[model samples]
Target: MKEIDCRGLPYLKIIREIKKYFNSIGEGEAIVIVNSELGRSNVLRYAAHKGYQLDEENEENRFLIKIEKRGCLEVEDEGEIFSILITREKLGEGDDDLGKILMNEYFEVLNEYDKLPKEILFLNSAVKLFHKDSMAMEEIRLLYKKGVNLLINDTSLEHYNLTDQITFGEITSMYDMVVAMKRAKKLIRL
Candidate 1:
């Protein structure tokens, strides 16, 4: 298996699209861009929910997403993940107010899907998602119950004085974040 980077591009769609594209090309490897840690996680978590075999110790980073193997999509070969890395807080840069609104709608979309992303992560100001009584907090709770892996930055909790306030997900370091990204079958942002 080879890896292709679809960073800043539409990676998820590309994966599905490749299944069709490869009909002509036959066989090859591809990568999909998932620029955020949360995005990377969402994909992996979704894979797990579907009952795909994931390497337990590498669960956080390397996602064993089997497209052709699962009978979900018809492809010539299986796939492997090299890694995924996310550092930014939001999917895009713009007005914070607008970004929040957009992000909320985006989560709503994710929630509506029959398959949710592998995980949701909170970092920097994005931790505000888990802030006390935020409007989106209930949705976070629902997603968590639905088995979507959730995480928050340990440093963010300390810097924002949120240790006492955050009520969702476990705390993680950059090391954990890197592992999750590296493990995803695909990554998404926004």
Candidate 2:
């Protein structure tokens, strides 16, 4: 089996390297070693996204993920691929406190939905909602656990001085966000 040592690499780099390696082979098995949880999560998500069979083992200081890449599995059509773009901390304008409450309620309802969006892109002040102390953190975490891709704006995190405070979601660039938006069959902006 091919071995890809991604230990100590950043999450994005780990993904890029793994993708490159996988694209080079036809049908094969490979092992990926990563040190950080973020890196491990990214790799496993990528593998699943590509319809690869995976087996994971946690060692003392790192994770070993075995991926068996055959032909891509047939995924049933699940209707239009939609995404949500959130640009503010609240749902609508007006009173700040009321907006916060409305936003919290909005997420709570969204979490209870049977069909969730393909992803939720957080930008501007919306990035603040992913911070550890955010009121909607629980709902957000639940959405994440339910398989919603949470993409946060990297620049917004820096602007709000919350780059390190964010505990969930993937920090992504505007280019990546734009690509995601373009790929979505429908987009709900707020």
Candidate 3:
């Protein structure tokens, strides 16, 4: 069994790395050592949600999680996981007003889905949507609350003078966003 040391890693990073490794190997057994309660909980939950077989050994302030990849959860479409990239304040390159309206409608529709994209990265003018009174704020907030990772580009937020206006999501660097996009099975741009 492959052994992974997850010390000093955030829970999300641990989960992402495990998922990536499982996808690459197809089937494998591995042991992960985690040192935080939040990390332990997230790791277990992720394993369960993806239908992997997991056994755990609890220690003082640490956990040894054994994961055996049986199979992945049943997805409607096989072999596809998605991430979303939104770089504009609006949806299309048409009339500005109509584009804004379309973007709002798009976010609302996304909320009705049973499964959301793995993450959503906002770049450029898209950061505006997280500011107060923004039309798409509520819908995006709902997605955030539903466990869809909402990330806003730090540079974009600063350039747009929206540094202090964020109402949801966490500020992220371009490097982090690029890594997530590259690691995702598919990336949908808006």
Candidate 4:
């Protein structure tokens, strides 16, 4: 294993960088080392929020990573965990207006949190937020601006004919969804 030096990057930047590496390489792992415990924990918190786990042996204030294969990453760090569960269409079922109200409330709740959920995964009718004409477009845009990751189902996009128009994140597979959910600390369903 190579001991890479990633000393100066911010937590989110490093996460994005690592994700990029994973994208191009299709698999690999890197240990994230920061100058301070706060930085390490900040990164760790996001990992945990996304339902990622640590190697049981990792000590507090440190980050450990060991690649299991080409594409899977295992990170261990000591920090609080948070989870956000989104498995629905339009934020809720039944009345459309009520669902809109609830979706706004969901976004507002996330806005108030000190540490938001690791990601917002959309499936089925839930993928509507990415539409250019969505009422929640601004709120979702704000969330993305704040470093929240957005992932929509690849097949869902095909179903809705949303393969174009969207200028955000990526289209993801169910396998990726499983990994995301596994890293989340708590899951909130709508």
Candidate 5:
């Protein structure tokens, strides 16, 4: 088994490193990853999302996760691979003020979907919705708790000066976004 010492590493960096490691290994091969307490849940979620069968344990002050690369995507119950990309603050091209209201309503309507989108990605101006003061906070939080992946572009957060104000989702890079979109069976851009 390959061993990865990820203590003190940020959760996203650990996720990226683990993914790189998985890409280099063959199916059925296993890796042992050690993470700090703060990163344990994120690591577990990432491993599961990537279709790795995992066995984990607490050792002293850290978590040891053994992950086997399955070489396949985890099959969702509905078997649909869909992602939503939001590049703007609103749902359509129209009045700026009204668009904000519409966007909030749109999130509320998202709950009606029988099968929620696998990922909800926010970029550019859309990333503002991830800030603590967002009107769509309630709906977005609900979606997150319901197992939908929420991703916010790091560049966008920086541009909006909201990198520190965000209260939800994983802050992601362009590379991550591109990779995720490529793997998505269906992608909706709004």
Candidate 6:
């Protein structure tokens, strides 16, 4: 069995390193140690997404995840994999305050849906929605907790000078955003 320690790493780096490790190994078992709940959740999601068998053990301040890469298990199709694209701070053109209210309500309603989008891509002014003080922060965080990939545009973050104010989501490039759009079964643009 191989062991990979991922303590003190960001969630994205943890996922990336684990992915690289799995790709390099053959049929074998590996143990991943993570110290944060977000890291643990991301690892579990990655394992499940790849159809790898996994078992988890909780320790005093960390989680020990045992992953076995025997073969990919058949994953049943759950239906259309859609993505939501937000290009503005608000939902529609109108009074800024009303638009803010509408956007907040929209995310709140989306949270009630049985099947949420596979990912939510934030672009342009929509990147502001990820700021720690944004009104929609709660809903966005909940969406992430529910396994919806929150992808924020890096350029937009820099444009708005909000790169450090963001509290959730992965900072991604325009190329990644285009790839996600192309791969989505359906896209809901806002």
List the lowest-lDDT window of 10 residues for candidate 6.
Answer: 71-80
Model 1 agreement with the true structure over 1-190: per-residue lDDT tens digits: 4343333444345334433433435344333334545545654554444333333212443333332223333222235322212234344687866766666655655555555667765667667677765566776678788888877778877887777776667789867866776677776543
Instruction: State in Å the error of residue 94, model 2.
Output: 0.9
lDDT score, candidate 3, position 69: 88
Query: Which sequence of candidate numbers ranks them by lDDT, best first?
Result: 6, 2, 3, 5, 4, 1
Give the per-residue lDDT digits (tens) of candidate 3, residues 49-102: 677888999999789999998755643565467999999989988799999999
Decoy 3 TM-score against native? 0.59
Q: How would you encode candidate 2's per-residue C-alpha lDDT over 1-190 as one tens digit per residue?
A: 8899999997656877777787798888999999888888988887886789999999988999999989876243557688999999987879988998889988876874446999999999999898777788899899998999999999999999999887777999999999999999999998
Whole-model lDDT values for every prediction? 0.55, 0.87, 0.85, 0.63, 0.81, 0.87
Q: After superposition, which runs of candidate 1 have C-alpha atoms over 4 Å from their true positions?
A: 1-91
What candidate 3 gets wrong by more than 4 Å, as runs, is 1-75
User: Compared with the true structure, what per-residue lDDT tens digits does model 4 show for residues 20-133?
Assistant: 554455444556555556666665665555444433224554455432234333343435555454555466568988887778666765664446656788877677777887
Question: What TM-score number comes out for model 2?
Answer: 0.59
Compute each candidate's TM-score over C-alphas: 0.52, 0.59, 0.59, 0.53, 0.58, 0.59
Model 3's C-alpha root-mean-square deviation from the true structure amounts to 13.8
20-95 per-residue lDDT for model 5 (tens digits): 7887767765554555666888888777766678898897877888888866676456777799999988767778
Stretches of model 2 off by over 4 angstroms after superposition = 1-78
* CA lDDT for candidate 5: 0.81
Q: How well does model 4 score by local distance difference test?
A: 0.63
Error of 2 at 175 (Å): 0.4
By lDDT, the better pick of 1 and 4 is 4
TM-score of decoy 4: 0.53
